[model samples]
Structures are given as structure tokens and as C-alpha cells.
Target: MLIVSTIGVFIAQGVQWRNHLQRIESRGKLIVAVRESEGIFWANGQEFIGFEKDLIAELERELDMPIQVFAVRDLDDLYGALAAGAVDMALSGTSFGTHDVIASRPYAMTRIGLVHPKTRNIADNPDLESVRTGLLDPLGHQDATKLIDNPPQASAVYDAGRISAELFTLVEMQDLDQVLVDERDFQLQQSVFPDLQFSALDLPARPISVLFNPREDGTLLTQIDEALELFDGSGLLGQMTDRYFGDALEFDYVDNLTFEKHLTARLPTYLSKFKFYADLQGLDWRLLAAQAYQESHLRANARSPTGVRGLMMITLDTAKEMGITDRLDPDQSIKAGARYITTLKNRVPADIPEPDRTWFALASYNVGAGHVEDARKITEKLGDDPDRWIDVRKHLPKLALKDYYPWTRYGYARGAEPVVYVANIRRFYNRIKKEYPQLDEAAEPERLEQLPDIDVPVFPGL
Candidate 1:
């Protein structure tokens, strides 16, 4: 009996020793499982990006440790990896489905809604009611031949096969009616293809957060929690949240009132110049104006403390590269800015979609194209969607860190600035779009005229 008791004590001591070692090792590094999507968190190649990026960074700082993010195919894959000890935890803001994974306190929330092609003429839910009644055919399987011919007038269709890539092709080809898709996807689509339009309906928000193994308890989990709380306290979490989801981030109009007043006065000066440049580039003048407003508040004299100068805030290096002698000259600045942006857009991989392409270009514009390229390669490595602005933007700042950038082809960069720049641009774009509803209509003719004329220069090859 004494021998058996001695053996039991030995087993207990071994377990205690293992636990102590785990706590010690946990202090040095934290492994977080993420996904391969764009917005919530995903791998872009070798880089992990999205809101989770900022979260992880903040957590690392809080715990005084390094974070190693692992990319999975999707949220399900992440959960499985966590269960199997393939990953320490997941930071994908994964939604709580009926599946039983251990989830921490809810970190963020967003309503999920349907998205569709902009050309679909879906102005609102009421428009959908008419389509349901029969203004258009309810799209269905191609082999099923029998579409709802003259069926109830409806605004949209919900069939699975009808709303995927095939449906988008059909819309491009003018084949079927509108497709019902996720609203976030719609926003992403609209950003990439500014020509696409969509509306939203109130739906239950999918509250999301990090998930962990139920049975696992180690130093890493506690450190992550501490980081989360620290970020939340410092307002960085809120900042990151707003950086991704406009609604999630809070802003004060009072602080913006003076800037708005100044913008109201300064915006008009760029209208004609914006139109001229937009026409030249085959872009919407309003979008250009929106971009300008976002960049420099339409101020010709605007300058960032970072040595970015002039009305359009063109960097001296960028100005010199573009062969502009006058950085403050509005016409030259606007022209050079437009050309540079257009060039950046053309440089992005063709497969990367809108908003993301545009966002990447904008990020490259803020940082350098090379840095943006590095971030993209990292994104691909991390398993996040490199083609997504929502995903890539999160990874952009990681370029600033040597450990992360060493793995990329483009080397290192100052990444955090792009995140702020892109988010600020998005907010200004949304604000301008809301204020000037007719701007989109006015900008259409200019975009259409320039489309065929614009020569998008290919990267590496060009």
C-alpha cells in the first residue's frame, strides 16, 4: 500500500513540474489560431492580418511576450485546430454557432445582412418585394431550366447556385436578376468595385470573439486575457474596431465640427480640378474628391508632420518620383496624385478585388508599393485573404516589425500608418457619399468615359 502511495505522489509531482514548465514557456510566446478570410482575420501568405492583428499586437505588449499567429482555412478549421492542440487559441472574432467551443467574453458585434450586385437596382427591401412579385426572374439552377417565369414580383433571389460566382458573371453578362449575399461581402465588393451597389436590412448581429480549448489552462490564456483587457482600457481596441467597422468605432462630431466647416470651404476648390483629373484617369470625380477629402481635407496647404507636404499632401519623394516640381500646386498635386493612385491600382495583382485593390493602392501610396507588396506576401503566408483590404490592412503594420517582415519578399516597412490612412479614407468616403448623394451619379459619366482610355500598367512586367 505504501509503495502504491509513493507511486501516486511521484505522478502528482510530475504533473506539477509539467504545469510549472508550461507556465514558464507560455511567458515567452503566445500562439493564436486565425482564419483565411479578409475582414475578421486571415492569412495573406506568410502574414496574419485583420482586427486580430492589432489585438494580438496589443496582447503581446500587455503580456510582454511575442505572439505567433497560425492561419487555418476558416473558423471551423481554427476551432478544430484549437481542440486538437494544433493551436493555442483563435483570434478570428469567430461567431458562436451551435458548436461547443470555449469562447471568451464577446469582443465585438456586427449585424450580418445580404449583399447583391450594385447594378441589380435593389434600392431597398421594398424594391425586393416587387422583384419577388415578378419584375424579374427568380434565378435558379441552370439545368433546372424552369425559372419562376412570371412568378411573384421579387426584389432578389436566394437560391445557392444562383448567388455565387456564376450569378456575378450573369450580372456582368446581364443574364440573371440580383443575388442575395452577405452584407459584409457586399461592402467588400462595393469597395473593390465602386460601381456595385447594395442596401441593408436589420438582422441579428453576430457577436464574435476569441475561442479557446475548454480543458486547456496555461499561462498563455491568462496573458491573452490580460492583453485584451489592456487594449480595451487604452482605447486601442476601440480604435482597431473603428478602423475595421465604422459602426464599431465611436467618433465625436464635436471634435470634427471645425474640420467639417473648414472642409466645406476647401472642398469646392478641388471640384473642378478633381473633375479634370478624374476624367483623365477614367475615375469618378466625386470618388476623387472623396479621396482628396480623406487625404488632406481638400486642403492645398495641408501637411503631415511626417514630411508629407502640399495641398494634396504629396510626399517630396513621391512628388519627385512623379516629376512634379511644385508640391503645393493644386493642379499638379491633384494630377500627380490621381496618376500615382491609378498607377498603384494597376500594379496590384489582377485577382485582388476592388476596395482591396484600391485599399492596397492607397496603402502603398501612404507607405511604399514595396512595403505593401511585402505585407501581401506575408498575408498569403499567414493564410489570410491577401486580396481583401479588410484582411490585408490588418497585416500592413506587421511589416514594421523585423521578425514578421524578414519572411516577406519586399522586406520591412512602417505598417501602422497605412491602417490609419485606409480607415480614415473609408470614413471620409462614407461621410462624403452620405452628404452628396448625387455625387455618384455625376461621377458616373466621367468614370465611364475614362474606363477605355486608362492604361493600367502591369507590375514587374511593366
Candidate 2:
């Protein structure tokens, strides 16, 4: 009798689990956990570029369910939210060994190390002592480095915030002798702070894999694992990693000097045109120049093979749609471009955040608004963040897929082009914002530029 009851209980539990999953599927949306931070893999931003984004997008395509990203304060908070069932699953550059959440196969190998300011060094071998280190919070003491006590120095261990930021801050402020960090974080910091110095002293052990909550149905874990397999095998992950870290863009000192010299000379003359549009749009003129530079290096006669023409590469179709008949006129073109960009913000779903909204608009400008909308529809269907550029941008490429397009409200688009186009624009935007402080105008063009003549471009291509 006892054995029979136990078996009966198992059968009932299976039914309940199956029903729960079916209900979730019927709902057609999945809730996922993510961490909000800078250096990539962040949800809210102008540029959402990273390897993690690639994996999540693939999962959405596979499941054909929309994925919603929910962010918690930090790793500890994320796991706590997971345990509380506040999130269906979580993905970040997080490590395992936290709460015994079921884990998928390791996606990538991340090196853990102690990072310090370039100006400072281990005073002696003993200085390595008293240095506190950690991967994430709970892994806090696991592979942490401590003072040998031979020199007996005091150091405070903090598992606070993203390890990357903490490490960056530590080096930036020369706060600690060293802060534990991953090689990726160190490299990222190095790119931003060339003068700063830091070293990567390896942890005592191997890095751990990311984890998810174990479920009896195993479906969630299975989906995640399969997605990881696909990403790893497809080489997309490797490309993203390489794009961010492998061979970062190198500025040519000589060429840059020449360009700067030219910009200094010509910019003053052209500055009036930019200022004209900036004032009209109530934006900083520098931002208008930045946009022009990104679109065509401020070249008024720039033309692309695709038939995109004019200073801003405004297609003839766009000019007509924007009610501008003159394509070559700089002032009219710039104003039309600004208005068109503004229109994109209004067109994008209200839920999407700023910068990302801008990114989607730019993608639409390069591609078409219909394609962007189609990507968003697909994003909604696939259980991803439709409002998030990181999530929706991934779907942009799929519009070209015949099978994928039929299901979308807007059909058949060359999705891959937008990703590259937006990425390039993002790089250009980031460079200007970083290198030129005076030009920054809340990172918004409308608020910063002053408009004079509204020159709209006429492209031969649709």
C-alpha cells in the first residue's frame, strides 16, 4: 500500500508539472533574469552588443517564445529573485556554486584574477597578502587571495556590485592594492584607461559555469543547454567575444592627428550649418555634426552603392516620406534627418528605453522602418524583449528567413544588415562621446542641435 501511494504521488506531480508548463507556453512569454551593467550584456542602453545577447536571442528563436528580461540589484539579488520564483530563469556572466541552481554546460571560460592600479604594485611578495579577491559575491572567499600574514597588512573584502565596476573603481581610485577581476573586465578597463596599470594574477582554481534553478521537468534547463550548444557550435559567440575583446579597434595616431587637423580647419566653416539645425531642433550643433560624421563623415556628396545619397545618406524614398523634395541641400537634409530620427522614437514602442530607441531608429534609417517593426514583432513572438535593442536587434536579421517572415506581422527583410549598420553607428557614437566631451548633449540630438536649413536627402534606392 505504501509503495502504491508513493507512485501515485509521483504521477500526480507529473500531471501538475506538465500543466504548469503548458500554461506558461500558452501564455507565450518567458520571464528571464539579467543584470544591468555597462561593458555589454546590459539591457537598457544605446548599444547592446555582447556574446550573452547572442545566446539569449538564439534561445528565443528556438523556443519561438518571447523572453522578458528582469534585472535585479546584483548577483545575490538575482539568485534570490530566482529562488522566490520572481524570475523564470537568469543569465548573466554569473558563475555557479551560489545556491545549487541547476546549471547548463559551461558556455565560455572566464579567467579570474586580482587587478590593481598601474601606479601601484605589490610592495613585496607579502603585499600580495591582505589583498582580497572574489569572482561574484558568494564565491567571495572560495578562490580569494589573502595576506600571508608574514607582513601582516589589513584589507577589506567587498563582494559589492558588479566585479567589473569594483575592479575598475579600485584601479581608477588606487583604492586597493588589488581587486579580483576577470581578464575581459581588465581588458575592457585597459581600453578605456590606457594610462592606468593593472595585472592579472590568476586564481587558484578553474572558473565555474553559470547556473539555473534545477527543475524536475528539465525542460527549461534542456532549452538553455540546447541554446548554449547551438551558440557555441555556430561560432557566433566567438565572433562577439572577439569583436569586444580579441582585436579591439586601434586608433591610428598619425591618421587621427591628420583627421583632427582637418576637422579643426573645416569644422568651423561647417559649424554654422550644424548650428543652424541644432538651434531649430533645440539640440546641440555638435551632436548634429556627430550624426553627420557617422552617416557620411560630414561629406555632403556622399553616396552609397545601395543608392543612399547625400550628407546623411537619406534615401530618396525617405525624403519623400519626410516631405522634403530637395535631397542635396545640407540644411534641409539635416533637418529632415533629425525629424526622421525623432519620428523613429515616436514609432518605436513606448516601453523601449532611450539610446536603444535611437539605435533601432538608426537601424530603420539604414534598413527600413517596416523591417524594424517586423523585427519587433518577431521579438515579441519569440519571448524576448521587443523594446530592448539587444533583444529585438537580433531578430532583425531573421526577417530575411522565409519561414521566419510568414509569422511576423511585417514580412521579409534583410535583417543582418541592420545589425552591422547599427553596430557601426554605435561605435562611431561611442568614440565621439568618449573622445569629445564638449560635444556630448545628454547623448540626444534633438535636445542639443540648433537648426537653420532643413536639407533632406533623396536616395535613388528604396
Instruction: Give the whole-model CA lDDT for all candidates, comma-separated.
Output: 0.58, 0.59
* Model 2 alpha-carbon drift over 4 Å, by segment: 1-27, 43-50, 95-99, 123-136, 144-156, 203-210, 214-217, 246-462
The sequence of per-residue lDDT tens digits that candidate 2 reaches over residues 252-307 is 33434444554556556567777676677665455556567667777778888987
Q: Taking the tens digit of each residue's C-alpha lDDT, what string does model 1 give over 1-462?
A: 999999898998884444421643544555566543445453333444467666767666665666666554333455555566555567544334344456666676644433345545544444344542111112111111123223356334433212233344455554445544334434432433333444443445555667766555534456556666766665566656555665224233443454467557877767789889879998756667766776777778778888876666888877987889888789999988888889889999999765567778888888888888888777878887677666677788898797897877777788998887776667566555444544222311111113221221111122
Q: What is the Å distance of residue 21 in model 2 from its true position?
A: 5.4
Model 1 TM-score, 2 decimals? 0.44
Alpha-carbon deviation at 341 in model 2, angstroms? 17
Candidate closest to the true structure, highest TM-score: 2
The segments of candidate 1 whose C-alpha lies over 4 angstroms from its true place after superposition are 1-9, 12-28, 40-49, 118-189, 193-203, 218-223, 247-462
Residue 385, candidate 2: C-alpha displacement in angstroms: 28
